[model samples]
Target chain A: MALMIAVSLPLLAALLCWIRPFRAVAWGITVACLTLSFAAAVFIASRILANGIAIGIPRWFEADGLSILVILLVSFVCTLAAIFAGGYMHHGSQQTARLWWFYCNYNLLAFALIVVPAFASPNLVWVGVELITLFAILLVGFENTPTALEAAWKYAILTLMGAPISLLGFFVLYWAYHMSGGGTLETWQGLYASASTMSPNLLKFSFLLVFVGFGAKVGLAPMHTWLPDAHSQAPTPICAVLSGIKTTVPLYAILRLLSVILASPEARIGNWMVVIGLFSVGIAAFLLLQVRDYKRMFAYSTVEHMGIILTAAGFATSGGEWGAVAQLMNHSITKSLCFYTAGAVLVVLGTRQIREVRGLFRLSPFAGGALLLCSLAIAGAPPFPIFLSEFSILSAGLRSGHNAAVIVLAILIVLAFIAIFLQVNRMLFGNPEPQSTPASVPGSVRTAILIAAAPVVVLGVYIPGPVHSLMTLAAQQLGGH
Target chain B: MASAQTQLIEGLNALDAGLILLTAFAMVATRQVQGVMRFFIVQSVFLAISAFLIGFNRGSIHLLALGVITIGAKAVAIPLVLKRTLPDDLYERREINQVINIPSSLLLALLLAIAAEFLVGPLVSASTDPVVHVNLPIGLAGILIGAYSLVARREAIPQLVGILAMENGAFFAGVAIAPDLPLIAELAIAIDVILIAVVIGVLTRDITRTVGTTEAATMSELKEEPYIWR
Candidate 1:
């Protein structure tokens, strides 16, 4: 019941917001829906912990450790973004009607995110992911500027192209299942159970299809061209959602498919993920250097972080898998915080070009210090959750005989650290321009940022007992013992 | 679980598979966006027919539902939507700017057909229905051509059509091989694809209105450069 509510409340809210007469009414509906969705998700997680239900709705939906973790993360991120977006756009130049439309699509997008982790069928899962792409396309172009439109176009074309490929993967998998005697291999759990007997060739091909297809959404390298444009062009709160929950949901799908295919005794899925993850990280490291827009730089950082998570998951060791889950949580929180500050800075300075702005510290201590803190936090500096998660990944890689992968990851992490901080440093400490006087920052925006950033600080030193077990259970769910 | 009517089902699928493959080639051969859309509509009609025939032969209500939705959504609904999205002057100059000309693309399509044939070899032999051995390759070839057109065509309209063609191809193979796959899954996909089409149509209309052209290559300003140099 909680699972169903968690998924449907946002969808219902989308409709209510879309048709509501007054903007205030729409905002109230939106807030009500997000709060309910978050509460439902937490309740579902609690039930799973206490009673240990099998967590399925006949054949349609299922949740396990993996779904629980991602659901919590997705719900939490959307709530934060909803809270922050209200403040960020409240002061914007857009009219009330357009803002209502934005709220409608935003909730629809959240609905898609929640839908994905709950599916038991691969077809339904693919549909969920495609819905994410569709809703995200609308969100990306909400501003309707030429740049925003272009980003939307690129996002639509590139990611939609990846979908057909994923469908082919499903075709191959379904065909394989039917060929192997149908009933026992129909669902995701069934497929995993029977994976060893399935045609290895088809499984291998589907893995590639599923990987690249879902990887397009996850912002893996070569398929990541749309990430920066879409993230930078969309309104900032939407950017946080794009970089935060939108990307991670698809990665969850990829991981689900990966879990089944990895049982085939060929190490291709793990090895290929390592190679792709490393390449993404390496490429993003260099691109981070060339980025002139602060938002765009942070977008590239997403590609890098995705690579890190993918590389960790690819290791398929308990430690590595645990790290992947931890990193996923930490990155979503930390990156959203970074984007919140970046959005605030964009609001204050009236530009996203790093070269145009100067002396953020002198102009506004709160915004400047946030810029400094967020940059340091996202750069994987010590005493941040990112650092701890990354350390876990490196140690796991080393322990698993992925020596070269660990080395490559370490080098890229260092290079990325230097590249990212240099950009952050220039904007925060450069000579103050006359226009650099702080614009009035919203109280709600500041509150949202602090709420998001607090976890990065605390989780660095300690993960609460429930959350630690949650990550471990999630890791086990993906790469079962 | 083998149905007695399986042989009749197989016969119909083989004929439809060849027709589907021909439409894929026709899509590649055509230059005009309207002509491409026609090929898509024809191809989808055949897909619905294929599903209907499968449903009748097997007497499975789910397959019948799949066929109905495929026709309603993909054949009747989506093409109408696409036709409405055509910019007023675009049809007069609808010839797709070629990254690779039609002749080269045709040759490439043939090669993809051959590649798909070989690729489907292992799975085809394992299928209980021989129709799949024939149908799966046709579907894969269509997917390949659709992918090719996406890259080769310069216009936004044709690229969108190309994506549809690829989707049709995937749906073809899926129906051919796993006709028993759930109805609700196909329904969800149909609704999602429609939503996607509607959204894409809105965006394309806006692009045409704002940029004065729907050529994808020209919308290049959103990069990390200091300026777009327009």
Candidate 2:
């Protein structure tokens, strides 16, 4: 019930906001609901961790370690984003109706994302994720600016193209499970239980279809053309949520599928995963070098991080699993912080073009400092959690006898690091651009930034006991630890 | 699960395959948007006929209800909606510009029909009804042709027609594979198709409003930059 409430509160808030005449009351209701959902998610996670049992209401709701981790991430990030939106919306020049629409769609998207991990059925889960894409299309095109609309349209078309192919793969899996006489079990469990009896050729075909289909959503190299445009064009808060949380959640679904396919002794899905992962990492790293938009550069960074996580999971070892989970958590926190800082920059400078803005520290120390810290965190600098997680992934790769992969991944990371640092340094230390009229910086924005940033910094230095155990359990569920 | 019921299932499957072939042929041959819409109406009527046939053969009351809804909503109401929305002046002129000539496309459709028949023929040949061995392939060919129509058409309305054609093929396939999928799932899929049609209609109007043309190629201004970020 708590899990369902955590997912539904935002939707409820959206409806309230829609009917309410006053904007202030709508913002208040949204914040209140988000705060309550955040509390509920933390409580649910603690309970799941304490009991070590899945809590679910059959087909409607489920919370295993994987779902719990994602719920916690969504609830936590959305709470901060809600705070940021309070300030972000106020500063925007858009009309009240437009702002209301943005808020309503944003909350609905949040609601859909929160429930996605809890769905026990793959078909329903795909529907939930597709709904998120639809919600995001509205949010991305909220400005109704031509660029924004184009980005939204491309996002909608490309993502929709992936859906039918993925559904076909799901249908094949349903047939395989039915033929194997595992009709009662739902989705992942059913497929995993019958993996040995399934036809190898059919499993391979299904996995390939599912991989390319979900891979498009994951923003892997060849299929990643939509991410940067949509991320850069969307409202800053939406960009933060998209880059930070939305991209990673779909990966959980893919990983679930991969786990099922890998359960078969004769299947070589892991090799395919590794190949795609390396390709994504190498391609994204090179692309990062040429990015003129700082937000887009950060978006590419997400692609790189996703590749690292996939590469780690592809190793299919205990250490690799742990590293991947840690990497995912670290990437979520770090990327959210990066977006928070980017939002602050956009708020202050009113531009995303990298060359047009310089010496941000001279203008607003808080925003500049946050950007520097986030850049360092994302680039895998010392004392940041991402560095530790990436190191673990590298070590796991070495231990798993994937020496060639480790070397290539290390080179890509190094190149990405240099490219990112150069851009960050240019913006932070170069001659200052002419200062324009400063927008009123909201206290809520500051608070939200602190809320999101402090975690990345704290986790970089330390991991709480419960979080550590939860990560381990999540990895174990993937047949890793 | 009875042998008599199974024979009824095989008969319904054969009818489904024939409906699918007709949908594919309609999709490939149609030129004007109104013509495509008319073909869609015909396809929906065939779908309703197939559903009613299934209901009669199996004595499944739910199938009968589905037949009613399919006929009322799809065959009657949706076509009325399409007819109202489509411009009468444009309906008189055939505006299709196929990359391949009619002969080639028809030949390709025929080849696809043959391939689908051969592919699934052996699988269903041992069933009580031999007609299913032929009908299943026709249904599969309809789906493939519907997809091909979507790919070939540069206009918004033709694409919408193609999408509807594709759904007909899927419905045909579903009847062949799992005739007993919960009524709720079937309703949901049906509603989804209707919603898609409505959405495409709205988008077409918006495009016409903006560019004064519904040709999809005009929307190419939204294409990706060669050096896309990230």
Candidate 3:
């Protein structure tokens, strides 16, 4: 019941946003619905912690440890981003009358993100992920500028190309499941439990297709061309949602399927995952140095962080899996904060180019200070959650005897760190451009950033007991020992 | 009598598969936006026919329902949505700029079709079902060819059509391999495909209105500009 309500809240909110009478209050409606949804997600998480799983339906709607963790992260980031949008969009956008459309799409995107993790069946999950891509395409193009529309076009073509490929993959998966007698319902758990009985060849083929197809959506390298454009061009609040959870949502599906493959003894793709993961990291780290747009800089950072998480998961050890789960949570929280701060900077300065702005500290101390804090945290500097999680991942990789990957990953981490600080340092410390006065930051934007920062700041040094257990439980679901 | 009926069904499915691939090739060769859209509709018709044939052969209600949904979504609804949502100028625009010209694109598509055969050859060999053998390779070929056209064609509507063709290809394979898949999934997927059309159509209209062209290749301002660090 909680799951149903949590999922439906956004749909209801979207409906209400479209109603003529509720147009003026769309933002209010969105906030209230999303807040209630977040509470419901919390309730579901508590239930998962108390019991082993939460099942909304016998074979369809259910949440496991990994899923509930993702669900909670999606809901939390979305709620804060929704709050941020109320102010950011109002100030930054020229099309104020269409604000209701933005809220409607935002609610729908949130609903899709939450439900992808909550869905039990893989096929239904595929549909959910497609919905995420389509809705995100609309939101990304919401600005309706030439560049924004171009971004949307590139994003739509690249990501939607993956849809059919992944559909074929899911069909093959269904074939394998049925061939294995399909003794259980074709859910994630069912697939995992029966994986050993299925043909290894079929399992591996399906996994390859899904990985390549969903890889585009996750912004993995080679197919990651659309990501920065979409992230940089979209409204800043949407960027937060895009970077924070949109990418993670598809990666969650791949991981769920990865767990199933791990259950089969004959099917092995861990080394390939490590190589692909490193490739994405290497590409993003290098590109990070050349980014002209601060938003694109953070966008590239999302790719780099996604690589780190994937590489950690590829390590296929319990310790590594724990690190991956931790990094997933930390990155989602911190990246959203980074984009919010970036959005704040954009709002105050009215510029996205790095060279155009100077002395953020002089212009607006709050925006500058927040940017400094988030850049430090996002670069995995000490005493931040990202640093802790990356440390755990590296140490875990070493403990698991993946010495070569560990060394390479470590170097890439340092490179990405330098690249981020290099750009951020140029912005935060220099002299302000002449005649520039700091624009006042909106109260709602400030509130959103402060709330988002609480987790990035607190989780670094001290992870509360419940969150730690949640991470551990999620790692267990990855089928690592 | 039963064996004769089975043979007739099998032959008809093979014929449908051939027509589907031919339409995919025709889509690649077509230059006009409306022409490509027409081929996509034709390809979808063949796809639905194939589904119906398979459903009758297996007595699977799921595949039959899937056939109805396919026709309703792809043949009927998608074109209607595209026409209504998109500007008339989009349909009239011709001379789609090609990354690769027609002959070479067709050759590349043929190569992609062969590659698809090799890619799925082992898996197809593992399954003894004749329908799987026929549908799987052809379906994969449709996907690869569709993807190829997506890259080669730079116009908005053609690119969108390429994606829908790839979807038809996937469902082509799906009906054979997972005929027992729940009716609910088919309905959702069908709706999802139509939604894809509607959303992209709206986006294309916006692009044409704002940018004055639907040539995606012309929108090249967003790529990374090499910055020399100070």
Which candidate ranks first by DockQ, i.e. highest? Answer: 3
lDDT of 2 at A101: 64
Worst 10 residues of 1 chain A by lDDT: A178-187
Q: CA shift at B121, candidate 2, in angstroms?
A: 10
Better by TM-score, candidate 3 or 2: 3
Report the number of the highest-TM-score candidate. 3
Cα lDDT of model 2 by residue, B40-104, tens digit: 87877776667676666667676676767777767776666655665655456858877777778
The global C-alpha lDDT for each of the candidates, from Candidate 1 onward, is 0.84, 0.74, 0.91
Give the alpha carbon lDDT tens digit for every residue of A351-377 in model 2.
988887788887778988998999999
TM-score of chain B of each: 0.89, 0.82, 0.97
* Fraction of native contacts (fnat) of each candidate: 0.69, 0.03, 0.85
**Candidate 2 Cα misplacement greater than 4 A, ranges:** A22-24, A184-187, A435-440, B1-12, B37-216, B219-230
Name model 1 segments beyond 4 Å from true: A54-56, A93-96, A182-186, A266-268, B1-11, B83-93, B226-230
Question: In model 3, which residue pairs have backbone atoms overlapping below 3 Å?
Answer: none
lDDT of 1 by residue, A142-183 (tens): 877888889999999999988888988887888777666655
* All candidates: interface RMSD: 2.6, 3.6, 1.7
Separate DockQ for every predicted complex: 0.58, 0.23, 0.73
lDDT of 3 by residue, B125-175 (tens): 978788899999999999999999898888899999999999999999999
Better of 1 and 2 by TM-score: 1
Residue A49 of model 1 has an lDDT of 71
